[model samples]
Target: MPRGGIGRHGLRPPPRRFRCVTAGRDYRDVARTQWWRAAAGAWLLGMTLEYIRYRIAEPDRAEFEAACARAAVPLASAPQCRAYELSHCEEEPGSYILRIDWTSTEDHLKGFRASDAFHAFVAEVRPYVRDIEEMRHYAPTRVAGAGAGAAEDTAPNLYEWAGGAEAWERLTEAFYREVHRDDLLEPLFRHMDAHHPHYVALWLAEVFGGPEHYTEERGGFQRMADRHLGKGITEQQRRRWISLLMDAADEVGLPADPEFRSAFTGYIEWGTRLAVANSRPGAGAAGWAPVPKWGWGVAPPRRS
Candidate 1:
């Protein structure tokens, strides 16, 4: 029999009412589950952290460390706080990184904003930083090298791959403590520490040269040299800082594999420019600006 809305087969049209009811149930279930999942996620957003990196001027490390220790303890034990630490960089002397982890972002905000002790600490340590360029906030996404259910490292490597990022953080902290002590680089940079001139020198030398590949090292080194053009940073200080970095890299098990070394060589070469540049500002960043001509003494080395 021929139907009004069907072909010769005479099948009935699909039931709109039945389809609507099924879809509505499914949509409601999905919406409800999504809402619950979001709520659960917010509850589990427990680990909030801030990584504050700085370069304190020379001669102020002891004073700054003591002030921070005195003022930081009260804020450290806040109900919302899980951990707090202050660390220096070994590879790059005079640089510091402070890591603070909170139970929740809300708790962290409350602790800093509401507490007088935290403010006191900030006031005490504020003068020490030449610049606090970056403060990054992070939440843990995954824990590497652990079993499906496990949160711990089963077999840690020198770099602590088994432990993951946590291990890296610990390695950096430990590396600094070993190298940047009274024994080395301290006597050399003492007067220049916390000085704006030194700050700008580093900004140009290490920070700028890494990726920019300044055609002449002068651009970067001049900053450091100009600051201490008269006082002078001895060649020994430069060499010591490099050695400290190398030792720290070794301790952290940063692979000295050929590939890594090749890359690092580039970094060192560029860094050398900054060092040389600042040593002689009269010429340029590299104190003695190399005037480009076709083969002055010997042919210039080819750029990689």
Candidate 2:
């Protein structure tokens, strides 16, 4: 409503909020804000942040970004590098900041500096060393998080990502439509129950971090394994099943993020491979095992 009073979040400045107006500036107020920030920074006690400010010409921006992308490979693999981000300045297009979080200042200087990953990282970014204006480590303060953020699910489970039971139902329904037409897999399910797809969907939902209805009402892994017994699943058919299911996933609009898709495919491969093995004569399928709840990158325990 008034000029010069609005803050970053579009709210009127609070008495406790930090401000930089020379007209009514109080040196004590500034000192109090710094004191509060340092005291609250306990959230990131041991971690050290290194902000590297770069002033690159407009022409060099593309090459600089590409170099940083290449350099990220080593940072991702390095033990001492906790996290990193290369950010662009909105107000000044020529300005960029590369922020990296290290496990500790000691670990970064003494540990990562001596590692092979650091050497590889340096080779990618050495050309821009002269363009850097600031490169130093600072500790994080309790002053974390942001406002007006997008609605992102921070839950670490695949079930939520797959959109629960209804999503699974859609997936199986679409998949069976393909299986019904494909000659390779059609004959295998020709004599199957009408509710086979529904049950299979339940199994999938339960396995990938959904509810335990498959285990609760329809029976668990043993029942599932027994269904495949003596079906004589072949490698060609197994691969075909995977293809149809993946196509169905696309058709049904499953989450296509790399992490989600990779984890989903990992489970599919595991189940299908085991199904092929268990369908063969006298194969010892696992029984009485607890139903697995798959997450971001977790896999079931090895059978052997």
Candidate 3:
């Protein structure tokens, strides 16, 4: 036990988060979990983090980013530099953080700073040096984890994700081929035009975030509803339609990732159900409705 109670009632020491020696172990008694602190500095990779924080006026933000982009190139090519990121604060737009990973502080100070890469890097960044609020090296906490990759990798919408218009055409064509052989669905489509597959492809493409050709060239929603108006699509036929489409998806090599498939299956089920209701004797809800733009239904594709 140390000396005083409230002013000295700590177990280990200050950084170890013990009570202020005299306070005894108050409500903040976290001394038992101090093991992590001791283990933290025993780094795994021995990497050093160099953080450079900057505060630039809003007008100069773009140019600052561009300058850092150029500077980052040399840093990336530097033998002692491992990785780096330059991020703008979303909440504080004029503030930016630049984090760099170096093999070691000594390598960054003694090796990288002495290299040609450093000269090139300094040339691009020198103008902003005065704006730097903090430029210091820190040991990695190891508790830090990576985030969702670089921001440049944007997510594609469902249309671009499905390999675009050509992929949808192949899918519909293959689907109709299966439909022609499926006894459950053949009677309904026995007279389906030779161009039916192509037109259906257009509709699907439009639904899944593609062009508006279906609405523009084809007569959009009403025309689509008109086709199934009197056929009285049965539940069995609707289910079989979905089955064949999925099979066609596999056969035509459509994306099989769970997210894409979930979104695909979602639209298929909703559309087929709507078709069934409209095909009934007097259903008219879909007659005047706009063509629905389908989205990544339940689970959108994972993107960085």
Candidate 2's C-alpha runs over 4 A off are 1-156, 284-286, 298-304
lDDT of 1 by residue, 1-304 (tens): 1111111111122212111111113233322222222221121224666777777766866666666666566656566665555656556545766666567677677766587756765776677655686787665432211123321113222222213344334444544455447476666555544333323322322321122223234353234335544435466666766676567657766545554444444444545554554556364323322111010011112224
**Model 1: lDDT of residue 55:** 73
lDDT of 2 at 227: 83
By TM-score rank, best first, the candidates go 3, 2, 1
Cα deviation at 291, candidate 1, in Å, is 63
Clashing residue pair totals per candidate (backbone < 3 A) = 14, 3, 9
Better of 1 and 3 by lDDT: 3
Q: Model 1 TM-score?
A: 0.33
Model 2 Cα lDDT, one tens digit per residue, 99-207: 6767789999999999999999999999999999999877643233223331112444577677888999999999998898999999999987999889998888877
The full ranking of all candidates by lDDT, starting with the best, is: 2, 3, 1
lDDT of 2: 0.68
TM-score to native of every candidate shown: 0.33, 0.48, 0.49
lDDT of 2 at 185: 94
